[model samples]
Target: MKAFQLVSPGKTELRDVDVPEPGPGQVLLKVTGSGVCHSDLHLLHAQQLPFPMTLGHEPAGQIVALGPQVNGWATGQHAICYIVWGCGVCRRCATGAENACERFPRGLVPGPGLGYPGAMAEYMLAPARSLVPLGDLDPVDSAPLADAGLTPYHAIDRSRELLTPTSTAVVIGVGGLGHLAVQILRAITESTVIAVDLDQEKLTAARGHGADHAVLSGPEAVPEILELTHGRGADVVLDFVGVTPTLSVGAGVVSSYGHLTVLGLGGGSVDFSASGPPQGLPWGATVSRPYGGTRRDLHEVLSLAQRGLIKVQVERHPLAAADDVLARLERGEVRGRAVLVP
Candidate 1:
């Protein structure tokens, strides 16, 4: 079998490895599609990593074999992999919020492509509990729902109370997650969806995904969002790019008492102050940094996709092109999500 492995810090290679068999409670999948995520690029250049780890987390495939003790899942069924492997005993997991499992390290996220062997290969091994049926959706295109779609769904679900018809929502960064965020908002909420992005192409894509307004992100973005909201600012701001500029715009345009969810790994921060508005977030505003979605979230995301309310705009590539695809993603040239077909 061929696998794309991170050999050392800031490097990756396509290497030959033996096919892994499913262990107890696990199922082996014949890889059909694996979505390439920005997180993979982050892991490539990470300061530290578990070398020789396979490098893909979002995978969709058909079940080929099930290990002992695994039941209810059958061979040849198409499924999407839920990447968050949480300790099921934790309080968070018990409540279906396993993305924030109590036993997970404070700063480190351990999952497929992070600490465990991933799906950027001919086959993948996943716990039966982590498998979500893909139904009739194309496995190659539906892979990104594992993360790009599910993450924003979780963030929006948490802030659903703020997205009433009279309210407004802003999405910053019209990349993979942001594009899906727009569609999710449109499908699930009546709040006016405003999208912001530096690239005109992405902004156009956002509008196509049902964003009511698209604003080119810059010094003018805050005012444009404010204008769109009639000077009240957005009731919810979802920042998919966590860089200083986008963070600044989100802080500038979120209404007082609104919710601001930052899902990007851009390594940026904002200052907090008692005197709000210009110096900090508005009074009563709340900010959250959410992780991946729980099992239920993944199921809901797939339901949306199955209903044709949302779809991932995917660009498929061969498994051997993993390096090139990561390069393109790093340079911000890949639109929508890139999937590796094995």
Candidate 2:
């Protein structure tokens, strides 16, 4: 199988590697679709892991083989890989919190394309436990729903209780996750959604997807968001871009008792002052960073896609064009999501 592997930091090699076979409780998926997440660049640059590592995490395809002890799964079944593999008996895994797998600390993150060899090649080996039925959804487009969709879904799930008809939700950095966040908020709740982005194109995309208001992120962003909410500010701020500028905008526009959930890896940080939050936040407001979604989150996110309630915009490329796709993503040329089809 030919794979696009990170032979070294900043260098990718398209080389042939042995296709893997499934072990007990595992399944082998024929590589169909894989998403190039922005975080993949961070993973490549961090070099925290070994060289020759595969870098895709969002994947979906059809099962071609199943190992022993794996029941109720058949070959040729269309499924989306869950992306998080956890110890079967652990409490976290028992409740579909595999993203927080206990075995993770032991260097086991059976999520193919990360700790495990990825679907960037012709074949992928993953745990049968990670397979979710894709049903009639296009496997290629559904790949981003696993991460880009699920990430915001998990963030919104936490603040769902706070969203009322009178509430306002602000989404900063309406790119991949940000654009999806807009749709998710509109689909599941009654809160008015506001999207902010430096790129006017993305802001336009956000509005087309269902954001009630879209603002060009800049010095005037805070005031515009405040105006949109009639000076009360946003009930929840989802910052998909974690740089200082966006974070500052997020802090400035979030209402009191609001929640600021930062999900970007832009290598930026915020310094909390003596006051609870940066600006308009009330005494009870909070800020947090949520990780990837749980298994249930994936299922729900996929269901949203299956029902046509949410859709991911993607630029498709052949597996051989992985390098070009990553470069375009880093340059922000790829809109919404980029999927590598093998």
Candidate 3:
């Protein structure tokens, strides 16, 4: 098997490697499509990950081998691999909150492509529980649904209880996840959806996805959101970028008792002061950081995809082009998710 190995920051090479066999409760997948995400760029360039590993994680493929103790699945089954492989016995896992599982979290330790050989190769092994069957959808597009779609789904679903037809939902940073957030909000609720971004192209894509309004992020953004909401502010604001500016904007435009969900890992922070609302704003803002989705959430996303209710925009790249894909993603040149084909 040939794989792209990230030996260290600023370096990645394609090399022939031994194909891994599935252990107990695991399965080996013949790699079909793997999405190159922004996080992969961060991991590679920022050296946020340990060296000498494969990087692709958002994968969709067909099962070629199954390990002992795995049941209710078979070889040749097409599936989208769930990125978060959690310890099944954890309390969070037991309650379908595996995204928050405290024990044996997959992403925390790094495996395949990160800590282990990732899907950038011809073959990859994953826990059977991580595979979600994709019966009819194309694997290339479905690849992003694993994280780009699932992350926003979990983030938005957390605030679903607060969203209403009369409420306003603002998505900050209308990029990969932000664009999907707009569509998800449109499909699931009647809330007025506002898309915010520094890029006009992304904002236009947001409108195509279902945003009622797309506002450029700057001095005018707050006033624009306020005006759109008739001075009430947004009922739920999801900051997909999680940068200082976006978080500040989210906190600034939230209505009283509104919820703000931050989904980006940009490492930016915002402060909530006790001083009387600046500029006469009266809202109380809470920032909730959401990571990947739980198994159930992934299932829900797959169901939506199966029903053609959600669509993913992706640029396909060959496994050999992993480095170029990462370069483009790091420079923010990719408009949508980038899927690597083996």
Candidate 4:
């Protein structure tokens, strides 16, 4: 089987590798579609990584075989692999909060494409419990839902109470996950959704996806968001671009008692001071940096997709074009999610 492997820092190659067989409680999948993420770009440029590993995390495929002890799933079932492979015995996992599994980094770790072999290949192996049934959704287009959709859903679900009928929700950086955040908010919440982005096209797309207002990200972003909310500020601010500018705007515009969730891997930080109002979070405001979605989140997003409530805007490419797609993503040239069909 041919797989795209990241052999070293700042490099990747398509190499022939032996097909892997599923182990106990695992299933081998015929790779159908794997979504390339921005995190993959970070991994490629990072000095440290689980070297020589196949590089993809958002996977949707058909089951080709199931290993011993695997039950309740069939050989031809279509499924999307949940990215967080957690120890089921842990307290967090017991509540289906595997995204924050207590055992993680202490002998447990992130699933495929981050530390383990991923689905950017002809075939891939996944844990039985990590598989979520797709139920009539196209595996190719459904691939991004595993992350691009699920991540934002998890973030919004956590801050759901803040998004009341009269409340306001602001989404920053309407790119892959940000765009989905807008759609998910529109589908499930009555909050007025406002999208902010530096790109005019993405802002336009966000409005098309049900955003009530589109604000170009700049010095005016904060004032516009505040003005739109009638000077009370947004009750929920989701910053998918966690850079300095976006962080500043989020900090400036989020209302008191509001929830600010940062989902991007952009290494930007804001100063905090317990003493005052202009330095950090305002009185009663709360902030969180959320990881990927739980198993249930994946299921709910899939349900939404099945009902025709939300859909991923995708650009399809062959598995061989992984590097080229990565280049486009890095240059901010690709819009929406980019999926590699194997």
Candidate 5:
């Protein structure tokens, strides 16, 4: 099988490698679609990941083989694969908190392309526990739901209690996760959604995904959000960018009892105030760092796609063009999510 192997930072190649067979409790999948996420670039360039890795996590494909002891699943079944491979007996995994499992470094999530060979090739292996049947949705579109969709789903679910019909929800940075956040908020809740980003293209996409208003982050962006909320500020602010400026914008526009969820891994910080006037807005703020979603969250996202409530916007690139896709993603040139067709 042909695979893109990240031999080291600043180096990757399309080389023929032996097809990986599923281990116990795992399954082998025929590669169909793998989304090129920003984290892949982080692993490629940031020196944060181990060397000689595969770099895709968001994957959707059909099962071709199953390991021993795996039941209730079979070959030829279309499935959207989960990247996390938790130890099923751990306290976190037992309580459905596999994302918090401590047995594996940086938690149990496979990191797909990071730790193990991911879906960038003709064949990949995954735990049968991570497979969710894709009954009616297109595999290309469902690929992003594996992470881009699931991350925001978990983030918003944490603050679902505050996102009431009368309250406001602000999504900062309408990129991969932010775009899906817009649609998820609209489809699942009645909160008035506001999207903030520096790119007009992404903002337009956000509006198309059901954001009631899209504001460009700048000198007047906060005032626009303030005006949209009738000066009370947003009730829930989700910062998918997690940059200093974006975090500042989110902090500037949240209401007193609002919740702020940060999903980006850009490595930035935000200062919070408990009393007195806030820095950007007139309210108290709390920051939440949500990892990837749980198994249940992944199931809900898949079900939502199966029901036609949400759509994944994708740009398909041939598997050989993986380097070019990564370049474009790093340069912020791709719109929506980019999926690799193997």
Candidate 6:
């Protein structure tokens, strides 16, 4: 099998490697497509992890082999690979919150892409529990639904109640996740959708996707949101880019009783002090950080994709072009999710 391996600082080289066999309780998938996520940029650029790291998690493929003790699934069955492989007996895993599994707190096992080999190669070894049946959807197109779509789905699912018809929902950062967030909000709720972004192209993409209003994210953004909401501010804010500026804008434009969900791993923080966005953290307004969607959330997202209620914009590249794709993503040149095909 061939894979793009991260060998040194901020570099990746395509090389041939031994195809991994499915161990007991595991399944081997012949990789069809894998999404190159923005989050992968941070890790691949740092190169702080061990050498020869395989760096893709969002994958959809067909099952080719199953190990001992694996049943109920057959070869040639298509499935979406669930990224967070959790310990089944843990409380979080029992409830489908694999991202919050207790094993991570105990240093028991790392996630598939973090420590184990990822899905960028021609073959992927996944736990039996990590495979979700990808019914009629194309594996190449459905790849982004695992992370780019699932992340926003989890955030919106957490803040669904606040997104009523009378409410104004603002999505900051109209990139991969932001684009999907716009579609999800449009399909599920009647809230007025406002998208904010630095790039005019992305903002235009947002409007075409479903945003009622697309505004440049800057000093003019909060005022426009306030005007759109008639000075009440937005009732729901999904900030996919969690930088200090975006967080300030997100917190500043949130209504007193609204919910602000920050899903980006930009390492930005919010202070509940006098100098923060709002004068005082008054009323029931809250800032919440969710890691990713639960297993059930991904299932629901995939179902939405299957029914064609939502569509993701992706640029497909050959698996050998992983390095070029990474550079494009790092330079912020890719418009939407980039899928790598084997």
| Candidate 3 local distance difference test against the native | 0.83
Q: Candidate 4 residues 205-256, lDDT tens each?
A: 9999999999999999999889999999999999998998899899999999
Candidate 2 least-lDDT 10 residues: 273-282
Q: Write the per-residue lDDT of candidate 5 for residues 62-117, one digit (tens) a residue.
A: 99999999999989999988777777789878866678776875543655785888
Error of 3 at 129 (Å): 1.2
**Per-residue error at 109 for model 1, in Å?**
3.6
RMSD of each: 1.1, 1.9, 2.1, 1.3, 1.8, 2.0
User: Counting only residues 3 or more apart in sequence or on different chains, how many pairs clash (N, Cα, C under 3 Å) in candidate 6?
Assistant: 0
Task: State how far residue 190 of model 6 sits from its true place (Å).
Answer: 1.7
lDDT of 5: 0.85
Between candidates 3 and 5, name the one with more favorable TM-score.
5
Q: List candidate 5 segments past 4 Å from native.
A: 48-50, 104-108, 273-275, 279-284
lDDT of each: 0.90, 0.86, 0.83, 0.91, 0.85, 0.86
lDDT of 3 by residue, 1-342 (tens): 988878888788998889887899999999898888777766777556666777787888899999999998999999998787666687887876766777754446343455566788888999888788998999677888988889889988888888889999999988778778888899889999999999999999999988999999998999999999999899899987877888888878888888888888788887866677765335566667777878889899999888988888888888888888788887889887888998
TM-score, candidate number 3: 0.94
- For model 1, residues 235-304, the per-residue Cα lDDT tens digits are 9999998988889898898899999899988998877888845678888999999899888999999999
Error of 6 at 232 (Å): 1.0
lDDT value, residue 330 of candidate 3: 77
- For candidate 5, what is the total of clashing residue pairs? 1
Pairs clashing within candidate 1: none
Q: Which scores higher on TM-score, 4 or 5?
A: 4
Tell me the TM-score of model 1.
0.98
